[model samples]
Target: MAISEPASDQRRAFVLDLPQRLVCLLDGASASHGRASLLLVVVALVAFLPGFFQISPIDRDEARFAQATKQMVESGNFVEIRFHTQARNKKPVGIHWLQAASVTAGEAVIGPSALTSIWLYRLPSLLAAVGAVLLTYWTALVFLSRRGALLAGLLMASCVLLGVEARLAKTDAVLLLTIIACFGALARAYVRPRAERTGDFRLAFIFWTAMAAGILVKGPMTPLFVGLAIVALAVVERSGSVLRPLRPLVGLVWCLLLVLPWFVAIWFATKGAFYQHAVGVDMLGKVTEGQEGHWGPPGTYFLAVWGTFWPSVVLAAMAAPFAWRARRDEKVRFLLCWLVPTWLLFEIAATKLPHYVLPLYPALAILGVMAIERGALARAGSRLAGLVWLWPVLAILVSLGLGGAYLWFGSGFGLAAWPLLALAIALLWMAARAFPRVGPEGAVLTAIAGALVLYTAVYQAMLPQMRALWISERLAAVVKEQGCPAANVSSFPYQEPSLVFLVGTDINYVLPNEAAALMKKGGCSLAFMDERFTGNFEKHAAAHGLKYHAVATISGFVYNGGRLTAITVYRSDDAPAGSGAAR
Candidate 1:
């Protein structure tokens, strides 16, 4: 009985331990899942936030946006976008509003003039990028496993174009946020039965709200893109009623309610001029003609996408065939409906900016992750196999070539270029080993990680040097150093908006004919003109009784990879003789 009693005691101990062990296992899994979620967030911040404010404001778009936000803060005009008293009605007020809010908040902390802090202008986009990444994870989880969700988030967060847009004060990053939100709601609405969907109106609410927000971000293109995807899904599913649960009438009401207030206010303020410029010139012009010299063949975006997506491009490309083959599957079908039509629309559009197709990338990332989860890459010895090997091969070669070029030609990078080369080599080694065994997820992560490292090194080492070469900030500073009053300086023939922000006061963008007269009427007026137009300015100056001498020769790349412009700074001494007659 005593021996029997010992065995019974042992059995009781085992029984008690079993549930505890299960509880511990559950706890561990929950903890691991939480950590996995955090990993992507950390990766996103690392990808986006570092050196974000370190680089000078990029010219044209970024500077234009910043200046508009500055105007919003100064003029207290929350609805209309303006640049130095000129209405910029092309884009919606969403990005400018957000930037204004950031500037306002930043100024409160750092004093009123702190609106000039470029990071504040860019913060919304960074947060939006992080939001987009998180939303992609959620969308992936709706149809994918936990690992797939993480991978999708990482892939989108690390994409080159997305990252670049995120770091800028551009509309695309925020536009992406609204896009993912709308798609996320669409994914949710589609997954549930029609009967069950009506029980929860939250999804429809989310979808409508996001659509309206997106429209605010970039005008009708947002709705057009999302509506086309929704329509495509309905058609492909052969259920015209697939969108029934969304209740288009109700959603439209919500969209109009959210978007109308500002649109109406701006229209009234500008006396319909806003619509004429925005819809007529900016929006319609892009549709009918290549606005802003961005014309390209239909395949322009298709070719550009590979480089934009980069490190993940091979897997994404491989995933397409498999994705198409499995198009009958509900999630795959939804992704196809979401990705293909929108992608085609952008490709067919008259204007082709790299960021125009950004809204389609989350779907692409989800599809790429689905392929990995489905063992598609494993079957092919992963993305590292065959001609896919050329990706890393070319990447390494490019890295080496760029590093050599920097060493030989570019200034300020110095020995720092070699670290980028090392990163490329490490990526190659990882790809060679991991792809065949660990598959696309592992190989792609290695590549993305290496790319991030390379970018950080290059940006840190080269941004200041690049800024010196690209932005007008240094030239503006030089003007300030020379005691040129902000109001007394003007740019001739060209209005680089960056000069407005960097110079700290509005510099008039004067016409060639008007520049000479203005200089002659004002004492010691300073004019910054492109070197190419010096002869034209000299002719006008000689005729207008303005004696001008080149103050300094300031040369730099207009922007990264843009034209190399050497601007001659000229200080004009007014003679006042027959000056007003020339005007």
Candidate 2:
């Protein structure tokens, strides 16, 4: 009853052709303009809404950005940005203004509470993330099939980097929106009918306005990225005429009109200090030397793409060979023009962060979608089966990795992880069955859905437990629970900015050796020190003529490395005779 060689070969060929047929059908359905818009709307909601405010603001970026915006709300100084009296010069004022406006709107509805209202500060990022996804989809539709546009939108929605940035208070998500807007508009203008597109003025205005917003959000980096793309496109097309519709002379006027008012005002307010720090130190320093300890060799961003894009990265890698094969094609050349130089520039830059190349991710997503639409995966024959199976295999590994990471950090998997684990197992089965039955696109979509589930689990289950590790919320609660006066508390070694925001007090920063000096001026003072200083707390207290006892010990991870630290609270018995405290 075994099949003959010819029959088996025929069946195999039919199976291989299924993906192409399904993709064509999908492309036809996606061709409807309304469907694409609806798909983008769904991506926007899913990308921004769920778990947007599930956890508190994190340390470093989110906490710092939120605090700065909070200061703006309190001070009403829109031109000069400040984070509790320390000038915040790391970023342009655009993000702060947006955050402030969001907060203001939220206040009108829910009443103002800087200490509690995080969702308002995160709203702009959510909206911007949605805009980035929509614009990327629209851009893909310019040159790609309908199926490619849907895939591109879905891939971006499922990206771990965009997901994280969407829910946080940061500049990257907003910056991404502007990048997509400007570039997408340029693509539209370039590809449209020459008579209709040329001197459209409206498109030129959109491009310039988006670029202006980008300059305001992150400063010169915006113009640098867009300008570089323009030059690359001109070279690849071998014609300067392609750049004509951009109307640089008039566009520059529009850009300056949109961006200069605040720059001039801030210059007068900071006496040019803001520009010196934001432009000179934070911006150019990354080019001249490593900044913020982010120095890496050329391969940093190449490696980062794997983690940054996650499930989508597999397709991105799969797209490379096809892209190279079709390098002569104009659309392929345009995508390469967008992705290559931007990627290379980041790699060559002296300083690097994982999210620095976020603006280029839309291109990667587009290329990956194009590869799938062109039937690259199905054309691989038997190799396609293995790649399909890789999805479930990686999903299981990610589940185990998440659980193991928490346990390694001395945290437990919460109840929410149960559903997450079940979802992973389901994805494993779906991937195993789908490729053989449905097609590669089916398997890829399943994988992308699995990634969304993973992000949900991370935000709802893992982050709440991990919040205390990077943030001071729990530590601050402990101080309040112990009835310690805000004025009497001090942190030794260093003070995390989040601690100040969380504890609602000014914590004096002191060194360990200086602990004795604190004892002399105290009324039953309490000191928080790094765990390394715990053993010597009693010894130091006794040496300084004070009685000390450990109150509580709190620990968590605070930085990029998985290193954990314990913070110990110590109480002294001595009370200043004349210094009666107010409760």
Candidate 3:
């Protein structure tokens, strides 16, 4: 009986230990999951919050897209998109469709005036930005550990180019989303091949479908990037057999089906005018001869842009050798394939823009994270620590110098921005003090975040006050007071489409030759002209027998040099006897 009693007590002890062990494991798993979820939420908030204050008005190509989408919605023509009285079929129909759909949905939910809402147009981009964050997180997880994924997300969310593009109503964000999605799917196909084997064809089909979506959103560059990366990865791994499951015929069929209808409709509707411009000029000529106004030096343009766009991540790029060393590791291999090929391709392109290289940013973020994880940044600690201390001392001296300069040269130096400068100094001091204790990684992140915050507070917060002091938002109100038809208003040399968008009018551009014809057609008009163009504009206006009276002038300062410029409005001398020919 004593032996049995002892055995029973031992069994009870083992059972008690089992439950406690299970509880510990469960608690650990929960903590990890919670941390990951919190990190993702923080990333999303960081990406979205800054845009709330920044207004992206119709500018350049954005104007073209907004005008086209507006026209399409009004015309109820889903297939063909038009802008500035011309069929613009160069870009695929995907973006226009998205805009139109948003406008429709917004109108239904928010009532009319939806078409004119910038937020409606910007909604898709905002959603795409969120998608980009989620995709970056998932992609990093696929190639790397949880910590790696968190770092990648942090890098991507902090990137300025991604932040800027995500705020604008453009195709780039959507293209990025699709590109990341396709790559994520490809990663899944590679990592979990056994699971994909049953539905391997379907998985490949979906991946290619995303590629097609990307192509439709941007152009051939989408497929080009995806294909190059995949092929390069396969070659590097010496595993062409991995690509055998991809169904080229099904992908082609899907792409043709998705893209053909719009192309055919555009061809018929424009009576082949679309073909000449879309195929011959916009698509083919852009690649061959380059666009008329937009051109760049062949090499290093992309590199410079990448450096500026994501300065923090670009700093990590110096650690590429460590990244290369880890190339045999699957995660590193994936990142290399994702980053290197796209970067090389863009670097080689003749036509380059800062935004064109946006697709490569996520891959670079991943690379940057990998580089950091591999201890590639440890070599810079001595220098980094020195800078952390040196930076604050230098900043304080610079701040004093700037204060002296401002006092000597100017008046009314407000204390509003001073607080930010002070805060920056404090952050620098704190970072310097914390460096030895927190280590290089924490110190670097702190410094980067401090710099970003200082920039945001100055540029975003201070600039608005300076702008308001210079340009009159009251111009729209004054124009309305003049009884000028909003549609009849025009600007010479340059166009302020923001005014047109706000006033719900078709703002006409008056070149030197057309000003006379336009004046004669519309007897009286309101116009705004930049002072820089005043000399040639006055000569042209005098030649056309037009009289003008200046109404209001607003002087605004440019931040770069604090130079002041004036925007002046004038009423036309000759009011058109009747409505001038439609602009």
Candidate 4:
């Protein structure tokens, strides 16, 4: 049944239409409609690379999570999270579970030291960020064109705030991804009306389940955000009918089933100490008291996000108008509901941090993509006219500014200096060559990603040298080498949990008043002192009749004001005396 070629006259007509067919194929390739999923994977990889390379271990909240997880793995205690030998019931166990899994897996492959590396601590967050990026792209595509979807992916990938979060071991990324997945599922359910009722039900159930998981990760705020967004979307769309398919009874059961086990276990184990700390202090008190020394003005967060999430900020701004214009549109309304409420809620809170607003980023990215697409079509003529002339002028100015910064502040013209200078020059050249054809949006985006990647790469390359200047790790190593039991060592004035985690020990703070009393009962005691606390130590130790000799002065790689002071470890004179040596 082979088909014969057409007659000569018919063949001539077919050949005449071949140009249109070829143009259609080219358009399809350019839009990359079939490969959108692949693009999302690529963007996620890009978002993850910086986090992978940057391994400057921070002794903050992330260190606490890692420590808790490590203890969980070793002790086989998965129900309650502990930090520095105390039941840390303030947060939920979702992040701990992820960290524990990463530690366990990494140990199997790379052995136990993986627990100490920044990568193991940060891997969960990085993976969650990747998931968030994929969800963001798919969510955007639900309502937007293919190009808009790509733009949204770009926005998420280039967001500095998200990038920073990806590199830290924190629950925020987990919370963010869970919320996003929920919303994405909901959006999908809404978009396809003829799609099976079962599909919608499944998606809704999954959304609620993810919310429950998020609750386990960061507590009630997860549901609070998800609930608010859903309510707002329902109100805007006048879609009272949309809620029916969610199957509230089944969904509620699912959520409770997923979340209650941990609560019950922790409640029984800690005899309600977990409940009080988690519900009373962690949730209510944290919001009202603004604990952990976190304080900010009402509008501070709005400004902070703007600075940290630059370039993405430009897209967010563009997206705002489109979101408003499409307020009646269900998809846009959903994104607006998610973005506006979450943003306002965080902004009004007494305790505000930059990462608190991460939930809104995906929504904002969607809006940005919409705005860019609309702008591109609306100003196509003007874009073509001005883009060619504007790029070279901007490139030259950027080049000069970069060169000036290096000449003024960087290590005055050495091998290190030249590489940075060369990078700057390359970026400038790229801007000049790419801007005319690609237009402002593409040019700006490419430049931002390039610049950030370059900066992150340089920072990561220098981190080992930078970390050597911090004595916390080295001091902790010394304590471990001496076979200091995990429970005995206490920090004075402040706590460096990272050190405790590194040394596989517990560290308690010696309150200003209790310092002397603790020193009197101490065994082979180690006390850390900096310039700020040297006076306090002298004043307290003299009052208590406790004598101390410096057992070690761990010099940090970085020095402040020609004084090589970071952390100094002291041994009590009561113990068998050892020589004070700098590590």
Question: Candidate 1, residues 424-487: lDDT per residue as tens digits?
Answer: 5666555545555444555676667666776675555555455435446666766655666677
Q: Please give, for residues 1-583, the per-residue lDDT of candidate 2 as tens digits.
A: 9756797677655544534554564565587867776766675576556667656666678878888887777678777777644888778888988989988888887784544467778889998898788788888988787667877887888787898898888899999998888888778766754455456587788899999999999987777777787788778767655556778789999899998998898888989998899878887899878887889899899988877887777778777788899887777777787788888999999998988998888988998878877887667566535555556666777778877766655255477776986785676456455565676576666666566667667666776666435437766666666666655677765477677666643455667646655755667566888877765665666677877666677766766444677788776667422222211
Candidate 4, 214-314: lDDT as tens digits: 98999887788878887876776666445546666788888999899888898898999987988897777656767666767678777886556654664
* Best-to-worst ranking by lDDT: 1, 2, 4, 3
TM-score of 1: 0.87
Task: Kindly give the stretch of ten consecutive residues in candidate 2 with the minimal lDDT sum.
Answer: 574-583
lDDT for predicted candidate 1 compared with the true structure: 0.75
TM-score of each: 0.87, 0.86, 0.77, 0.78
Whole-model lDDT values for every prediction: 0.75, 0.74, 0.63, 0.66
What stretches of model 2 exceed 4 Å from their correct place? 1-35, 47-50, 193-197, 382-385, 408-413, 467-471, 482-488, 512-526, 534-551, 560-562, 570-583
Clashing pairs in 4: 468-557, 469-556, 469-557, 469-558
For model 1, give the 10-residue run with minimal summed lDDT: 574-583
**Cα lDDT, model 3, residue 531:** 76
Which regions of candidate 1 are displaced past 4 Å?
A: 1-33, 244-248, 381-384, 397-410, 521-524, 535-550, 559-562, 572-583
Candidate 3, position 537, lDDT: 61
Model 4: lDDT of residue 313: 64
lDDT of 1 at 183: 87
Between 2 and 3, whose TM-score is larger? 2
